[model samples]
Target chain A: MIMIILFVFLCHAVTFCQIEFVKVPMQKKRPIHLALYQIKLPLPGVVSILHRASGLLLFLTLPLLLLMLENSLHSAQTYASLVALFKHPLARLSMLGLLWALLLHLCAGLRYLAIDMHLLNNLKQARESSKAVLMASFLLMLLIGVRLW
Target chain B: MVSRVVVGAHYGLRDWLIQRVTAGVMALGCLSLAIYLALHPGLDYQGWRALFSGDAVRTFALLFMLCLYYHAWIGVRDIAMDYIKPVWLRLLIHVFVILTLIVYAIWSVQILWGY
Candidate 1:
């Protein structure tokens, strides 16, 4: 087992070293590394990416959310017990995180809605919508955070 | 060609109708939820139960759940179209989501019905 482990480690290290070794092309070629720092992604791009990310998070975290809701609704005693459980710091933080995720997701959904309504079809409108999403998400997080606190 | 056009028209109309209907459903549900939250103000275990157990509340809550699932499904479908590459994998993912949503809707109904 030790010998096999050592062999695997050596092979991995060799591959890692090769990856780190950047090949400098003599000619411009296809100019693959075009102006490395010149490109700037817009707010809409960032918001679009975060919308998908938050959606994934919500999807993966859904089972826990459903469990909590079910537990809280089972009976008066179970509901009280669940509420008490949420008094812990970890639970509070988790709930706050969930709220944050939800706020972002809702903001993104609103952006989609605006697009669907043809309210933000142009470049300028799209940019403004993206800014609105960010601002709205921040404001929501603040309100919810205060409430949670 | 005529058959293809007829089937295409059917799907297009169906999807368009569903999108509009679900959008309206979610809007109403969300508006009611907002009003409920604003009016109630505080949260207590018994109060929460009483609040949800009423017939009007139960019906609205069921609509809310349905709208939520519908909206979520449409959103996920868009994401799958944007990201999922292989047609077979996309179909599998869509089937899984449909099954899960059906189960969740049934479970929610059962709970809401006091069963």
Candidate 2:
């Protein structure tokens, strides 16, 4: 009976030591192996990230846009000057970019709202909606760009 | 099985709701502006001024501005919480952002109602 107890205790001790050793290396190796750049995100992930980017862009530009609106509405002279500024090629290009960003953001926001409503709760539907958003926004941007040019 | 209860500042639902509501408001504002712009093409000074001259439009614009600020605050705060881990640094950033947003809010009011 004493010999059997000793053997069982030894087995338990060995297994516990193995577990501790394995856990230590895993904890140590995790941060080094984690690489964000190496990961390939899916479509919905890309759309979600772009939504954040566009939101940030819009948030940052709010001041500039408000200032422009204020200046344009301030007086006839300022308004004319603003119009002339916008007529420049660089300004038009930037305006186009902003317009596209706004449209894309709006589309993505609607998709998110749908998801929040539990409309597209499944992965497949979510992916399809994200793709639809991308295509629709691109098409709208192209149409608007043609009109602008 | 053992279960653990987690305790923290629980404002997630409130923030989520606020963001959605403010987004809806902003969307409405954008739609109105788009319609106005489309109706009045080649918008010059007087035309632009006329568009905002109405009491309804001005009120909507002011509401839009307020919604924009709140929407931005929630979004930016979430971003900061995600990327900035240090407690003190995150707090400092939060302060700075709050101050800037307050300034913008005041500025927006001045612009909209300064006539």
Candidate 3:
């Protein structure tokens, strides 16, 4: 009720002053176009996603890794059996994938540590760091691959 | 309606701090393990057991496991909160993850000390 009275007095004052009014449409709700495939990720953005992906992969497989540790610790026989399991082609492939994941996660995590320390302040430095991380991880994985083979 | 305005503000700084702290702890643990491995090559089951049998390394490794789970909780929680739109679903996942990490901690203890 008080708001209604104030509006009436404001209307009278506006009329006395002969102020012109302009109309505008409501644009509070705007359309958003967010197509995932249409978007291009920057180098650092790609590295960020890969970091999360690798972490998630490692996380989901934690149980299996823990089981391997358990077996290795159980006894010599069990430890030999676990070592034998690693020789299978499927096992080796998955091991490679996991190694790569660990490498990527580790490198990206170190990069994040540097970022938290205010080292990668500029866009160029961030991008370069991301590139360096990817290269280092990939090269490390390849080195592990050669040793594994 | 009940207000849900303050959920995001309070936990942000704490979780950020935890994630970095846990990362640093785990990094140190891994670095020490790597250095040890570099010094002692061709580790068999006995050799590996000897490494973990030490009190200091074993304690640090256990600490690393705890940090890993806590760090993982924060990361996975953020992922679920981002990608899982349904509140109930995210809550369910959060609960499951908490339970699983608890189990993993127990498993780590068993692996390190249990026969």
Candidate 4:
């Protein structure tokens, strides 16, 4: 937990430092700074970024998920065994991560669907809607965690 | 420009339709299971074994698994396509998901048949 937080903070620090540099004449031309922070990236933008991040995490975590599902369905004995394994500390932690991933994926996927349907298009509404989706995802994940343990 | 937009919307509409249809099937299966379990709250291991031994229940269970797995696969694929950007990585992920789904389907069949 602390390690994850520190890693995130370290990442932000590195990114900030890289972006806050004094321009030095280099032998080669530097890539153009394309970050939109200078223009005040809004709440909707943050939600969009997180949507993509969560999706990528889900993609990377697919193998473990498939194995879990497969093992559960292998037989009655395997199913019972696997469910019992879920009582372990690491399993509980992973389940917590899964709950968060599921909530985020649902929230962001619903937002994408709304956008596809041409709803929530206005700037203010987009920001407000994204904020609402993010809050819902957080609350849903919290509920899942409480229910699990 | 117009053609490209039309093609995009076409695929979007198809995806939307498939997703909704699959969701409906999954909902029905889940509701049936929930109601059945609620009605038979005291079912023991042998009782469940006997119940699942019937053709109707076995077929229902198989179809339920298939629909559920397919729906989840579609959802996962859409999520991946939305996020993963690198061409090679995305392709690899997609292939891996497909393989996993295939393996899961086979496992589901085996479980349903008590193998």
Among these predictions, the greatest TM-score belongs to 3
Model 1 chain A poorest 10 in a row by lDDT: A21-30
lDDT to native, each model = 0.74, 0.83, 0.87, 0.69
Candidate 2 residues A1-149, lDDT tens each? 99999999999999999999889888878766458889889999999898889888987887789888788878888877887898899998887878778888989999989988899988899889999999998898888788657
Q: What would the per-residue lDDT of candidate 3 be over residues A1-149, giving only the tens digit for each residue? A: 99999999998988866543322222434557699899899999999999999999989999999999899888999999999998899999999999999889999999998998899999999989999999999998998687557
Each candidate's clash count: 0, 0, 0, 0
Candidate 2, clashing residue pairs? none
Off by over 4 Å in 4: A1-41, A59-63, A69-80, A117-119, B1-12, B19-97
Error of 2 at B60 (Å): 0.8
**What DockQ results for candidate 4?**
0.12
- Report the lDDT tens digits of candidate 1 across residue range B14-80: 6555655775676677567667776877777777777777898788878877876776676677678
lDDT of 4 by residue, A11-107 (tens): 9998887665544544246777778867676888888777666655665575576566556545577667876898898999977876676577567
- Which parts of model 3 have CA positions greater than 4 angstroms off? A1-38, B5-10
Docking class of 4: incorrect
Interface RMSD of each: 2.6, 1.1, 0.8, 4.8
Best by lDDT: 3
